[model samples]
Target: MVLMQAEKTAIGSICFLAGPFTLLENALVLGVIAATATLRRRPTYLFIASIALADVFASCFFTTSFLDFHLFRQSDGPTAYLFKLGGVTMAFTSSVGSLLLTALDRYLCIHQASSYKVLLTRRRALLCLLILWSVTIFISFLPLMGWRCPTGLIPPCSRLFPYVNHGYLACWTSFTLVLLTLILCAYALILLKAHRHETSMTSLQGAAGTGHARMRMDIRLARTFGLILLILVGCWLPALSFMLADVFVILTHTQQRAFAFCSTLCLVNSAVNPLLYALRCRELRVALLQLLQRLCVIGRCKKTTQDLPPGIHFTEEISCTAITEHEIPTNGTMQLHSVSEMVNN
Candidate 1:
């Protein structure tokens, strides 16, 4: 009841905040994809793109629960709503699974550059995502296997457990710990490799082109993701431990609210990934901005090109060997250009 009331008063707050959060994330992503027009050309963005979309879905999912209870009176659905089965498990599996694969993609891109082409292809990304979702689905549904639902109940969330939810207890605990450990080791390897990379470059002449920049960006991404993994673990660990302790001894209502509160912290991870990648990876930012600019041009030119039939148009969104504004000397000018080819019959 307390949680429900708190959520009610918080609707305006969530809408004001989470809505814009979703928009910027969505625009930056669709702008990239639309401007690129071809996925193969921008393979570096594949993982982030996938995760951003998944984050959007995740935000929608969790918000539904809050909105349903807070905004709608029981008389509106009261008993006939489909909201219960809509959000929770699907959102969890996709969001969490997406993060895991995001790390795996980064590992492949950084560690195995030789076959990064062959290994992290689009099909491979889709297949990995499918596998992750399949596993998440299997585990998320485990609670349903033994539990029975009480009929005519709105939301069907209450009476979800005969006792404590042992299924949830086991799944979230093991999954968070294992993923957090693996993400740590993967990032540690990236840092070690980055150290070796920097040392091997003997001169300023050697540190040229996108190679050095790419390496630095990858290292930064690894560090950011490592922090994200830590945050994921940190956010969930308290709640997880508390829940497990409930099995040993009864938990007070205060303890349950504390556990519930912890889940909201995951939203921070969902919120910030866009800013991190945009700010950290120089080439990606260039590509993204170039894409946006190209889209604006296309928008302006759409009605003017009447002589041309329905023909395909291509503008380059890929910009390699970029020196970001921060890196350039105060007196030096940063030269940035995109190589574009317009295709017409």
Candidate 2:
């Protein structure tokens, strides 16, 4: 009892401090993605946005629960655990499931390059996201709906900690393993095709222009997705393994402490996702840079309107003036120039 309580406090403290920061990061990523028209239009980023949204909610739920406990010294009651469990499961599942859809989308793009757009239309993508959320919500609330918690206990509340049900654990583990395997297989085939195409490009005559561009894009995408997969596996594998073990093998106090560690480690995935997107994605990097520029413009009042870039503002209105000049010099040479500038206070 003493060790378990200690584990919760120690682990919970770390997560409590980290939660707000994670929330901010994911929120910024989502903001950037939403603000940029180019990113929001892409089918892949649609899934990325879904993942970011899930993480944001996860951070909110987790942070709120932790604040209740840390600030007010609240007990581990049913309500608190319900919020925590719902948030964690939904976030984790959505993040992983988003990756699965992304991998499958990339595979289709590679294999059916001509028909990819026709197949995965915006409507279809939206439908997929809707289904993903529906399934995730259902699975997350199963325990609350009478799967594990016994009947006739006080005013109806289940004990906190080790919410794992053996039947649910088996089903969850199987689903996750299968989905991850599919993601791996899809990426493997993508890498293989990229390698072959790159080799063939090397042998082609005068293929440097488009061929090199395509090869670079393919290789960069593969690497980005590969990094995402690695992060996902590293973050979640320990938690999944321990969850599986808890089904058959009874864990000692030490093992339970380790489970606490694993659980926190998994939450790290949500924290690091925005960082990964910012670093690995060129489009997102550009959007982040623009966002920062806008912030800087809003902060400093000394910069002249002429110095600022076009259309960078917070709540300020940008009024543009366009003037065209046509001049005839002594040499009878005619010149025309057009200038457009935004007038700002």
Candidate 3:
């Protein structure tokens, strides 16, 4: 139950270092999406933006509360502790939900290319996000709403005991496991469908060029999804398994330390998500670069916008025009330009 001084320092140091980096990475993803009007209108980017926003909160709340509880040992009331954990729970739950929605978006893009846009309109995407966050908030705060540990018996409750309810943890763990399984199945079907398309194209005469292009897109998407699955399983499965175990058996000190490490690994996923989903897209990369460049220009120029150099104005105009002129490639039945261009068409 108690971590050694060295163990505490080690875990705290990792959280301290990784927390800001995670926050900054996700924040940049959000900034790029917000700055790019073209990306803002699509359901895909909206899901991605939702993930980044949740990660931003996750990084902030988890790092602060974790350090407070484990390292600093802040003397806080039960209500305050529950609030911190609820925030962490809500943020992480929303993140996982958004990821599931993103996978569904990709599935529709591949399987229902013709009606992907109609199926997932921007308004509908926003509504899904609203409902996801609403449900996540309610579920996360159940412990605070009279679901805490019963009036203390002998040995205290498990890991998140006395603050978070065991039943809630079990249910949440089951939900996460279900989400991971669904994501795996979704990607499996996508790959299978792509394989069928490739085989059909190869057998057909005069459709090689277009079919090959679409196949290449599918393969690239498969690779990206593979990486995502790898990370998700690597980062989450251990912690989730541990939590599930904790629900049944009281974990030893060593197991507790391992769980702590696993929890930190989960935070690493938040940092890497932008790389897998956002920066991999050429459009988002360009937008991020332009956003950084604009920030640099603004930092260097002390004068007002009207007093800026004409060349800077010209550069801005050209960048704007370039972004506006960029077109989604529509070849065969697939109209994807990049990994994150699912709903852009």
- The candidate scoring highest on TM-score is 3
lDDT of 1 by residue, 220-258 (tens): 756766676576677556755775665455556566655
Off by over 4 Å in 1: 4-16, 38-44, 70-86, 142-164, 197-230, 246-248, 298-345
Candidates in order, TM-scores: namely 0.65, 0.74, 0.82
Give the number of the best model, judged by lDDT. Answer: 3
- Stretches of candidate 3 off by over 4 Å are 151-156, 206-221, 296-345
**Which scores greater on TM-score, model 2 or model 3?**
3
Candidate 3 overall Cα lDDT vs. reference?
Answer: 0.81
Q: Looking at model 1, which ten-residue stretch has the lowest summed lDDT?
A: 331-340
Kindly list the per-residue Cα lDDT of model 2 for residues 124-147, writing each as its tens digit.
998999998899888877766656
Ranking by lDDT: 3, 2, 1
Give the RMSD in angstroms, all C-alphas superposed, for model 3: 11.1
In model 2, what lDDT does residue 15 have? 80
- Model 2: lowest-lDDT 10 consecutive positions: 330-339
| Residue 224 C-alpha lDDT in model 1 | 69
lDDT of each: 0.56, 0.69, 0.81
Candidate 3, residues 172-264, lDDT tens digits: the string is 899989988998988888888888877777677557487668778777867877888999889999999998998888878789888888899
